[model samples]
Target: MRIEMTTLAEQPVAGVHICFFTDSLEPSGLGVHLLNLMRWLNPARYEMSLVCPDTPGGRWLMERAACVGAVVHPLTVRDRRDQASIDRLYHILTSERVTIFHSQVGISWEGMLGLRIAHRAGVPVRVVTEHLPYLLTHPGQVAEHRETTRLAHRIITVSEGARRTFLERGYPAAQFICIHNGVELPPERPLGEAARVRQELGVRPGAPLLLTVARMTWQKGHSTLLAAAHKVVARYPQACLAWVGDGPERPQLEAGARALGLAGHIRFLGQRDDVPALLGAADLFVLPSRFEGHPLAVLEALASGLPVVGTRVCGLEEAVADGETGLLVAPDRPDELAAAILELAGNSELRRRMGQAGREQVAARFTARAMARATMQLYESLLCEALGRTDGE
Candidate 1:
């Protein structure tokens, strides 16, 4: 089906309506993805309607979102039907005349159903953003992914490393694109006064400070990072580690730290919104996650000009240039991780150089504007292709 063009008071637009069908817009990576995209998109050219399950955060955010002139539709989703999300999504597509459908995390069974619905409604195109390597998530979803990709006009991956995983899983390269996760850069961060944050964190001057910003989960590799810190402190006794997030795995990880006699060396700061300031005080940043697609924390670290040390996993490899921008070691290797951290912590030159290099990488390729521009261009291309129009003539 061809998308209808809309006429405004002064100009005409392609009349593209985007429908982001997700389970909910709670405090998660996918929610962040939705909000960030809405923030960066060109409002004059595109219209958006977010279809999600009812979530918290009051009318403050929703009211503010409406003030900006986008539509938010709440859904009462039930996961028991034959692709109920997909079925409901079809109704929304026809109702809103959506030109694009974007879904996050894994392919929702209902999400695939929705895509099929939109396609059948003559919406012309569908899009899916894979935030993680999902080839191993569920066998049925994997099959659905194949079918959806075959039907979709385009597919987006958060990282190049993740794109490779999809290709390995037999996803067609012809329809795939890499639009790395983009975040709004704070206008100005006075990284000067670290005294207050440091005092609050209870670290004396010249004490080696290491920081991590992630949820407490098995994939985050907090357990292994803690083990690495144990050996790190054994070599450099004054070193300390601070974590800035909480999750289901926190209690168990805390117990493991106690068992390893690292209770004092590690500080669980829970969740904090002072990440920008926290990155300023830290000497080194570390994220030894076992798996990832594109970690926003790593991006924040690099943007803050902190030297990051993470594992050689999906998405990370795309942002961190091995031994150039940041150090990448094999996951679950506390010994190698410890050595890499020691190398950065002990040498101020390597830390400064890598930190500078990391910042340059972020500026060059990972800006929010860049990500949004590429996404809009892709959406337009898909729309145009479905409309039987070639680029510009």
Candidate 2:
């Protein structure tokens, strides 16, 4: 049952080559987000291809990309600046007959090389998705984007904030399009397993379990969350917080937890594939990210029926509805963050209501199907302009 229907032969999306040039796909997040979108894109209407650099996690992407059943090509692009990698990418575009390139990464040298190859291949359209906030810390990214934006036809950003930044940074105002990250709904099954999942994870019954799945990075606001956790523990000692993913900040965050006397209450789960299970066990989902380009983990939490508490950052604004689906506090404010989290943690009825509301919101607006359809329509529009079938230009 498709919403917007177009026949396979009439719209025949065979020659479309979508290249995913990234450092890796397994450290997860954006790569997985792109994979989910590609997997959901209707094969009858679009053909997908991926191109990622050789990294520790590249093998995982190759494996997942294969399982998605698409024409997958692996290219070992050297870390951004290597000229040899650029040459190899050019060969791939020519040999594969790639006409459209879609990059879910930013303006790295590797990404630049891919775009160069696409331009050389006479690829009518090149679309780059901005997955990070570039206005503040990454001014180089904003500049690189401006330098490359002229070569590409359009820029696809996950948040209006990112788009606004690009416009502010001298990128062509007309070339940006905002496409929010979406989630695929969880399987329809009994939620009773949540109790078992929580038990195995060592979370006591009726004890507030605040869950956050993210890399321990500054952008994710781990520092603020850590500070807030101290406040939550001070008030509700039985309440616990879980960090599902690990990163460079893990040791520092662990130190903070210990210093704050939250040794027994906070658990670092590291990296795990059982996110759905974790979401099931969680009472409240929190993402105090300083900024985002639409967080996939938070979307999954909402899809899994968990109440949320997040900051008012780029992609987060589109995720948590203020005082409705969840709470939104000012970025970097641990006091405000702690208050919101504690409020939800203390109120079981509010948690359930918000979680239900979140589920309904995602079901209606953000879904894998909806994202795929919208992306495919853009692809068709670009292809039509190339084929001279419609006046897309």
Largest TM-score belongs to which candidate? 2
Name the 10 consecutive residues with the lowest summed lDDT in model 1: 4-13
**For residues 1-393, what per-residue lDDT tens digits would candidate 1 score against the true structure?**
223323111222367777776553343565666667778888877888776666653233354456656687666343536455545655677767666777654423435655555556666667887777754577876776577667677778898888888788777898888899877665456645677887788787788889998889888999888888878888777777999888889999899889988888789998676888888889989999998888888887888888999999988888788888779999999999999999888888888998888888888888777888898988888766666677775
The TM-score that candidate 1 achieves is 0.87
In model 2, what lDDT does residue 195 have? Answer: 85
Can you tell me which runs of candidate 2 are displaced by over 4 Å? 1-14, 24-27, 76-81, 106-110, 136-143, 189-191, 391-393
lDDT of 2: 0.75
lDDT of each: 0.75, 0.75
Candidate 2, TM-score vs. the true structure?
A: 0.90
Error of 2 at 384 (Å): 1.5
Error of 2 at 173 (Å): 2.4
lDDT of 1: 0.75
